[model samples]
Target: MNWQRYYKFFNYLNIAEADYFATPEKATQAISTYNRALRMLKNNKDQTEAIKLIQTIADDYPMFPEPSHIYGIHLAEQGEYKEALEYLKRVSLLDITDEMANMLQEQFVVIERELKAERSSARTQTQKTKETPQNKKASLGSVLQKAPKHHNKESLSKSEINAINKKLGNEDPSDLSEEIARENRVSDRRFLISVFVVAVLVISIFYFVIRPAVVNRLDGGQTVNQLQWLENEITDRAKDDPEINKLLNDYLSEFSDESDK
Candidate 1:
């Protein structure tokens, strides 16, 4: 829907301007346009136009409930009630599936029987135009009355304030001022707890793990150095004779094996 895109842009404009209601009137207009187009296309019987609009709407908004509902409505008028029922089943118009869709199915049944009755009673049933739109309010007036007031509270009605207050749990206006403060307090507490956990983990690793491992490596290195010094002393003493040199080699080999273990 072009109206849908325009409505999204309206939201962006409100956010960008920081007005929050920058395009409130325009947004209402867009919604009215979208709804009007949906209703018109639902009733319009021109098949080519109907097909093109329905396809466009469905292509643009596959997830919406209206496009498929209208397709079913058109199919129903064209005597494809079963297929119509399939598509109509997807929508919740007037809670149609509960009692609404059945209204359509019942109508179809009555029409089918009426066609039989027409054959028997030939000129019996009378049809006439029906009045709709009971208790209708002016569109502009309704929009103005129902739209939220982002303006000052002095301009807000008791009903408007009450509606707004319900969403905020009937709290004082002063509490509304502190809404962001509440969120900040929660975030600060959560951040502090997370920092404390991380610091504890780091400190535990340094004290219980890294420090002990460093001490063990230093002790093992000293033992290796002492073993090497003992081997050098034995070698110097054995350098005077060949037999002693062979014995010294075998003894040092045994010491090397023991040190490695």
Candidate 2:
């Protein structure tokens, strides 16, 4: 079933608006649909229907400010001037481009004029609410603007500003103390890190280079070699003793003669 067309035909707002906002091209199609709905409503005097489509136009594609402004103008056309102003004000606050802002500003001027005309004529001196025709619902904003001057100043009084200051009080010194404590903790960490790195360097030198060299000497790297040389010197010194020389020569000569024969 072609749900979009069917839903649109029967004014099924929820169902018909689904796939219309899936992508940019689809958003364009949706915008066109919204435009058509607006035109049809204006021609047929269906203000309620037009507002619904205008709402959908902004809702479905909020990234584009064009739809938002158009929707606002449509709302204003339907005598929902306050709501229209809110939508346009939101567009301005959203950092929309200058061109769109200017266009909407012009449109607002026209709507504001229309609203002023209606609010001035909506009430009777008999305190009776005079019925407004299609486009004269007394724009709430315009009525408030044109209402008799009220003296309640918008600016805060000096006492009120002082009261606000008293309510705020001074910033707690405890927070500053806590911040200082945090900085001290960070400094402690840095000191510990430096100490740990130096300790590792010292330990590495001892184990890999210093300890190994000491171990080599103690385990007979050069000590045993020097002992052998000393032994040869002692034997040479002993040869000068007559008895020791006779005994060494007799034993060696006997062993040598036995081996030869």
**187, model 2: CA deviation in Å?**
99
lDDT of 2 by residue, 122-228 (tens): 64532353344322555866788888875886577665765666679844454358789999999999999999999999999999999999998887857877866
Off by over 4 Å in 2: 1-53, 60-63, 123-261
lDDT of each: 0.57, 0.65
Pairs that collide in candidate 1 are: 96-101
Q: Model 2 shows how many backbone clashes?
A: 0
lDDT tens digits, residue span 1-261, model 1: 021211111111122332132255544443344454554444543546645566455444434444555555556666565666666555544332344455445545644564566566543322111212322435667888999987655777666776888887885566466687998999999999999999999999999999999989999999989978987876887788787789888986887799899
Task: Give the top-scoring candidate (TM-score).
Answer: 2
User: What's the residue-level lDDT of 248 in candidate 2?
Assistant: 58
